[model samples]
Target: MSTLAYGCMGLGGGWDNNPVTRENINQAHQVVDTALEVGINLFDHADIYTLGKAEKAFGNVLAERPELREKMIIQSKCGIRFADNEGPKRYDFSAQWVSRSVDNILERLQTEYLDIFMLHRPDPLMELDEIADTLSVLKSSGKVRHFGVSNMNQHQISYLQSALDTPIVVNQIEISLAKLDWLEEGIMTGNADGRDINFTAGSLEYCRKKGIQLQSWGSLSQGLFSGRDVSHHPQHIQQTAELVRELAYKYNVASEAIVLAWLMRHPAKIQPVIGSTHLDRIKACAQAPLVTLSREDWYNLYASSRGQEMP
Candidate 1:
């Protein structure tokens, strides 16, 4: 239950046209070192990042700094399989797959157990009872301490929880000023023009009421806040920049900090999973917990995203 979860995606040795090398590993070490210096107690990972290269890369660093292991919480996700590089993707939630995945994670992370283990994404065909049974076994064996899901909706969460004895601790999703559908309606709410489709409804409020923590992936909007044209959608880009600037000035921090703070400001007590390859950006995200935003500011940004004032 770290206040902020620092993502290790970029550090897993890819993105930004940066080749994964010894220098990259050294930079990752530096990033982790900086995160430690700033009191970032949680490190977030996924089994599929960099095609399973991320965990091994992080393992190298952890092996070197064995002493730092006690000071941090490591969480990794499983269940998504990228057998084909082009991605006719598959998901495996069977007990056997879950057990094998945990074994691989432990070996790659160079750790005995994970503080939190999550299903990377909800499998449409998954059997809740089967998945839950696997989690039970893992918990009993000390392979995973807590259980949760990523990219899941309320119904999906409920389906899994219904058959499981373990408490679903958190739901990690894409939530940002740019992606606010979960706040307005459920994830099933979609726009007619085949655009502006939302998938989760009042997800923030739901998690709050249920005592389920919310973790945000793509906290920087997939580098959208970095002033890059991720989609070439002019309006989206304009709105993101404007909101980032306004909030930055109000908070007296970097634009990225405002974005992170907005998610952190929610009542759900969100822990943003920052995916930055640069050490400096990672350090800036570590400062997010310190930025406090007023209710009005949070709503103002929300309105900007919607392009209308709240009723």
Candidate 2:
């Protein structure tokens, strides 16, 4: 069984406005069941996800089915604060905020500890020593089993890693066929042409070297490969979708599976986080681990997605 993680961001209805309802709880329960049915053991959540409604709904289902907790690995993130009554939209890495966020995450998930707790984003003003000491305290107290960060570059992760004794287990970032910089960075190096690819500096190779599991968010690229409107999409997106669709037909799997399979094919072992709320789409995504793309096919997809053959 593939260890694809299910993202709960789109759960509990709309974000910033709609509070989690009983209907949302019911939907969450169904989604969780579907995820487990498809061998997805990891559930990803963030404190800001739907204003915590995602975790609330998840907690509701777990409250009813406490047994299911043993069958899953629960992870949640913090450090991102929206501009409501607070100062402005910002990232807070203060020990106090991290502690409080974990408390709320635990309460909403109806759990004693999170398998993994991540900083949602890098706070420019983060105090390394203070954050490290704080995370060490949390780990010792058994509030969080492991630590990580999201949307962080290699240097940011390196700075954090330098302070902590525990390893940063994962780095979740936006990665998809549509977002090709991870691949482009290595390809463009030492070339005279010097393509302008704004990838996080050496983060992909760094993660591979450090054994940090790379978890991909926005993994499906908003379903561009899964029958999203080709007419409205860019020419490259259309070409990428076409190639993905052709591969899907050849591999006898859904187009989403092909898209995700491409990510999984990377040597870094990138885990794609699926956020689809639709049951059928979720099931289709589960087929990703089953499809293995050949070397030729993988490069073809990459070249097609890049809208040009390699130089």
Candidate 3:
């Protein structure tokens, strides 16, 4: 496996509001084509994307190109519920809800089974045994081949693992230069005695140690690096931009490649979920696998983000 998965969040919502655009659909198809061409074997998706519009769009693409399914790994998440123009959203991890959600995902994607299905987020009121039993049934029934979770901390993962027979394969978390608290202590830094350190202790390093793939969302820092200027941001963004520019020139590639390279440089083998809606940007992301940043450069970028040298 390439250890790099392409994210399809843009297909549902995020950029523009044109889900029906022929140009957009064609661009998505082009992304798939490019991904396969460049050896990207994994595709990340969520059921709540654009209120399910994203999966429907991708389903159309898969239906049109049936042969591509056999060549790629398709992963999707569920458990989030949205209200109608009002009220707070909710999460449901009940057995019935999970079963129905998987069925709906299969129907929307026009597929019989998903390679991987994840709980979109940890439900505070969820019963570990119930969730595990549901996943166990889904796996045995062939509705899903694997199970995982998104935005889950170490404690949540440990709790679910203890109740489930299956091993969790991946932990999808928000990881990027802008998000590094997970790499350090769980403390969010700057706050006194904070409970949530932005992530759990040893989460990233633990994933690296345990062979659980750390899939990075917000890989491009929500397109912050794509901007042409960094004057309004902190000095770290500027410094990182300079290093990215330097590496881009050396590699003869886009600055995005440097950003991806920085993530890839980590020992954890981080797989970035590219959120770009542009075909050209997707292609640029593909080039990231080819660009190799030196240890010094990688640490330099890291230091810039940390605002200090590594001890």
Candidate 4:
């Protein structure tokens, strides 16, 4: 399985109304170079990221270095539209939107076809048949090689997959030491207190059993021990940071490696989508694959993160 994926959300900095420029493109190239140096070959993008400048900056890299295209797996997502004066921010899974989004993504990424394409989020108003047909057309036309979804639950993925011949290969969701809901839902299962766990029941297990790739966002938990003052952090975060630091010292690696190793220790073979733009941070995160947490240490970190013992 792929060890990790680089997220382009932070590329082409500044989400203000400003348009992406050559400066952003240069910045993206630097980050991409650093990520490649760290052996991360998968790049993740969303149309709404940095107002679409993320893709443009990344595309600019490929335009300048066409050879880089074959060395990487580029994936992007669409269907999230901003709120205008007309209405609130919403999702669009309409056939027209999916078709047009793929075209725009290819143009911005300076690529002929995407290795994978995913819906940015679940579209409650989705017409499954229409979406299935749209995806069929895109796949048959050689626009997208594979399909996936982000922030979708098991039932939603099942329903969508049922209507399409192409399989949903990945499901990206927020998972980290700081975010315990994903694991808490299962750890607390069979107990009445588990009712409050809002994560979709059996979602993690479903993905694991179906061989669906589980890619995590916020995999580093926003830098638990990145020289920040943990005193001001929440009690649970403070505790988790302390434990991570201790484990890092014990394992002779950076704290990021400890956190990511905890997630990687799971049986699901999760591929974390790391968004760090700092070269040093990327290098530190690359050490994640080297750390092997024992079963006892892994649960200790989990209990520390959740501020309680596992059920």
Candidate 5:
């Protein structure tokens, strides 16, 4: 699989009841072309993105170009439910819901099997044996090839894995130059200030030790250090942006690439999910793999983003 994935959250128009327009499908086609041109074979989706229109739009593209399916690794997530008449918006991990969600996901994606099927979030009321049985059935029936999770802590992962017949292959979380909690938690371990960090301690290391892939969502940081205006921002952000631009110029890649490179430079081999719908920005992000930051440069960006020297 490619280290970078094209996120389909921006596809199929807005989050309203409006039906998908032909323009939406055309836009999906363009995004697919650009991502494939840049060697991104992994396409990520969620059942709730644009109320399922994102997957529908991509399915339309695949329906037209059936050959494209063979060239891609498609993964979609479930377990997140929007508020409906029966209940408030919440995560559902029940056997009935998981089975139905996988069916819906496959139907929307227009695929016989998903390369990966991930639980989008941890459901507090999830029954380990029940959910594990549901996933096992999906895999046995050839609806989903592998399983993963997002936004789960180490303890949650371990408890769930205890009942699973197969290994969890991926853990997606918020990891980027802008979101430093994953890194900060590690460096702040055993310090009084570490209590303020929100990340789960040992989560990153647990995944690494178990050989689970660490995927990063929100990896671009909303163009914070890339090209967005930051004049009114704090001095640390301004300095980070300046440093990112300098590195981009030196490496002959986009500032977006530099930001992503900083994350990719880690030994964990984090895969960044690029959510940009713009062609230019997508192209800019593809250049990330081409530039490898030096050890000193990596620390430089990390320290600059931290606003102070590391302890």
Candidate 6:
């Protein structure tokens, strides 16, 4: 898998009930072409993205150019359901739902097997034994080659892994310059201020220790540190944007590369899922691996974003 992945969240049109149009399919083709051109082979998707139209749009691209499938590592997630007659919007981990959702995801993507099938989120009502059995069946049937989880804490992942024969290979979570909880969780340890951080303690270390790939979801921070407007934003955000611009010029790479390089600098080897659909932004993001931030520069950017000196 590449250190960077092209996210398909923005591939399909809107999140409405509208069907996938030719325009959507063409856009998917362009995205795929650019990602591949820039050496991004992994593509990320979720069943609920754009109401499943995202997968449908990519499926159209694959159906027309079957050869491209061989050049990609396709992964998708499930377990999130929207509100309907069944019940209010909730996470479902029942055997029936997992099996049915996998089938639908495969059908929409027009693929034989997913490189990695992730559980979108934890279901409060999930039965460990039952869910493990369901995933075991999927693996036996060759529908899913590997399994992973998203938005799960270290305890949740360890508990789930204990019940399964296969290892949980990836843990996707929100990690970016804008979201500093993951980093602050470590720095603020043994301090009262750490109590307010939302990220689960030891989550990052657990993944690194267990050899589980840590994939970042909101890795770009919505271009907050890149080129997005920040006039109304906090002082730290505006300052971080200016620092990112300086580093981009110093390293001779795009602003996107500087922003992502901050996350890549961590020893965890995080795989950032770049969610941009624009060709220029995609290319800019692919330049991240080319520029590695030194420890001093990395700390400068971190402190600038946090708007405080490290304790």
C-alpha TM-scores of all predictions:
0.88, 0.97, 0.90, 0.97, 0.99, 0.99
**lDDT of candidate model 6 versus the reference:** 0.95
Candidate order (lDDT): 6, 5, 2, 4, 3, 1
* Candidate 5 off by > 4 Å: none
* Residue pairs of candidate 2 with colliding backbone atoms: none
Q: lDDT tens digits, residues 188-274, model 5?
A: 989997789999999988999999999999999999999999999999999999999999999999999999999999999999999
- How does each model score on lDDT? 0.79, 0.91, 0.80, 0.89, 0.94, 0.95
- Per-residue CA lDDT of model 1 for 1-311, tens digit only, reads 55778887766565333445777668768878888887787888888777666777788888888887888889899999865775677988878888999999999889999989999987777877788788998999998999888998887888788887778888899887678776666423453432455665555666787888889887788767655664666674577677777778777777778888888887778888887776787777776777988888887777767666554
Q: Report lDDT (Cα) of residue 278, candidate 6.
A: 93
Candidate 1 wrong stretches, greater than 4 Å? 15-20, 84-87, 186-197, 229-236
Best by lDDT: 6
Candidate 1 Cα deviation (angstroms), residue 75: 0.7
lDDT of 4 by residue, 36-83 (tens): 887889999998888888898899999999999988999999999899
Per-residue lDDT of candidate 3, residues 146-246 (tens digit): 88889998778878888887788888998887777765463344446445565666677666666778899988886566555789888878777777777
Winner of 4 and 6 under lDDT: 6
Q: Residue 215's C-alpha lDDT in candidate 6?
A: 94
Instruction: Compare candidates 3 and 6 on TM-score and give the better one.
Output: 6
lDDT, candidate 3, residue 135?
A: 95
- Candidate 2 C-alpha lDDT tens digits along 163-191: 99999999999999888888888888977
Error of 5 at 8 (Å): 0.6
